[model samples]
Target: MKHPRLFLHVQEPALAAQLLQSAVVKRFIVVKSSDAAPWSEQLLQQSCDLAFIQADQHSEADYQQLLSSNILAEMDFIFVSDGNPEPWLDKLMRSGAGYHFRQPLDMVCILDTLQDFYQQLSSTQQQVKANNSMLDQFGLLVGSSRSMLKLYRTLRKVAVTEANILIVGESGAGKELVANTVHLASYRAEQPFIAINCGALSPELVDSELFGHTKGAFTGALRDHQGVFAQAEGGTLFLDEVTEMPIEQQVKLLRVLESGEYRPVGSDKCRQANVRIVAATNRDPQQAISDGLLREDLYFRLAQFPVVVPPLRDRNDDIVGLAQHFLAYRNAQEQQQKQLSTATLQLIAEHRWPGNVRELKHAVERAYILADKMIEPDHLLLEMALADTTETELNEVPAGVPLEQLEKAAILNTLEQNAGNKTDSAQQLGISVKTLYNKLEKYQQTEP
Candidate 1:
């Protein structure tokens, strides 16, 4: 593993000198604040892995400004103070900083702590790399897009709390996955996590499924059945396609969320609801409320923390990463080692993933199964590619237009249509994805 790049924000000359010559200093690449330049600037100038800040030395305003800027978001901060940190610095530690080192610098102790921290950081990075390699399966959802990363951060914060969450996204965008992630991240992780699709069941059964039924409650109700609310006690109950719930059921759900109490279908005795509620839907919550599909009052009650899952089209940077991850995952599962060619990667990157991550994964898997050692562009059966090139063959290029320019236009046009999915564009152009990438690379060289 590479050594960590570190920043020292110690303002005291003697302490700074001590830290600079410390045993831990030899383990990392450390940059100290030399002049009046902002610590964030110094840190950003290079790829910093971690930072040690003398929180007590900085003013409250300076500390707050540093935090508000979010300059240290990607790295861990270790605060060193002469004594207990000031209230504001303590709050900072509570907010996100991992460790605190008290003053009267214990070099040996500091080195040991630093070693432990490095080990942990290295382990976490490896896990993230592994997760990214798989793409679709990471921290409950697979995505590296800005929207997805923001969603992950939000979930991490909201998970430890008891707040209800509303996940709004398109179908197959992994709303239930978000719910599961929250549950697993929370203190209730050891308990059960029960999920029920509100759209999949009838109105009558929806009530029974969520709240359970007593013995002989209805026809074929032989024994008492624990409802999802009870089954998910001490954990979470994920309500999928929540908009599909009947108005009457919505009222009950709202009541349950509000009072944390519910009744079985046949039993009058009310049971305490210990499970956290996580509701999700593909439809717009506001539109659903306008259409009377979702209760307006219940919408407010469930949306304690609303998380919107971005569609595949909106996450352009994540397409290739997710596609490759899907391919590797398939190879692992089926004992096959198929890989995507460079040209194919470009096509995959260019195509608009209308179905989002779900569509991308399925498409990659389909192509992987058909290809030999390398999954070429043709293996990716994109309908848009076939439709685009049906009339314009390569040899039928119009006169006066340079052949290279025409080829570039065709490639670019196909890419635009497919929303930058390179796999589809390459397939449509009757070329390998690698060849398409090469041509584009050469065009960039000539054009630039």
Candidate 2:
């Protein structure tokens, strides 16, 4: 509700008084300046939101002082000059003036210009507030590695589209962060962005939870409920660990995707949903389909635009940046400033981050709480040697294991954990079913 402050500088006291008579300029301070030097100095100290300077009969020293004032950087200035503004207008604009007004200025036009300026300023302030909130809450993905840069570029491009995105990556790889960035950048940014973990729910409950259910729909259906689809109307729904969704639930999800309509569990009436779908998994979905754990059609539907988020170990260059980012965040929370030691950074870079970003975040938080001053190498508790063992064991065979064999094993492990569902598996793996299938086929062919 705060109004912008406008300062008017004029050499003619009569004209300045007349301009002040206008309702639009009534709130402004009109100054009759003999030279621009005093006005320029005052402009630098005062929080002037906008400035109106009369350019008719101005001294050369006044012009020089006005041009050199640093206040111009923060204030939007308009020049009121007699005669045509053809030549000087461009110069004023280049010198940071907002606009140029010729002589015989209509009061109505001045009012309209002021209104427009305020409106634009309000809009810009809102945008800046929103951007700052996003950065404060979500922070950057925090990586300078080539793989991370590729992921960042891909995320930016994908955010502009309204496609059904399928994110595939290992557990703890910040899949949810990617989902958040997409929602923040997308057109539906002003709407709700809801995230649900499919693997956390049982097969029987997932249907009711996702599609909603009516009172007496099942054992615990005390009352009618709105599902995630309904809750995320006109927004986005992020389904995490999607491959864990049961085969029955997958069919229901596919129907929703295809028709944009879904019925509550115990209700026959179908409701419309205008929601964007973005699913993530840390498991290979293609292997789930080959193993008869996932449906092929559903896999393709959710993978309209598939993006793979690389793990932390794979993007080594992002370690220091991410570590520093987390450290700063923790420092802010604790109200205590602490820096990470060089040795700690080196150790962190050398260690294989199996848990990915989530794990790294937790580790930093823990270190911040435990360490009294600087975070040293000893503060980090990562098991370096055993980091790749799980992935390696999943890849090995009796003697010579084919690439496809390893992929199938990885997929099967994820499917079993997810109870034989591909959507949830793909969400867990953080890769599209298309990519999952490519690995599946490659592994199948290597079966001796």
TM-score against truth, every candidate? 0.65, 0.56
> What TM-score, to 2 decimals, does candidate 2 have?
0.56
Candidate 1, superposed: residue stretches over 4 Å from native: 1-126, 129-138, 145-147, 384-448
What overall lDDT goes with each candidate model? 0.72, 0.67
Candidate number with greatest lDDT:
1
What would the per-residue lDDT of candidate 1 be over residues 12-123, giving only the tens digit for each residue? 7887787787776777777776666766566667566677877654557656765576553456677778886487776566555457788687867777777754643442
Q: How many residue pairs clash (N, CA or C atoms closer than 3 angstroms) in each of the candidate models, in the order given?
A: 18, 26
Residue-by-residue lDDT tens digits, candidate 2, 281-347: 8888898788766678988999987888898878765666677777765666658788888888887
Model 2 CA lDDT for position 220: 78
Could you say which candidate leads in TM-score? 1
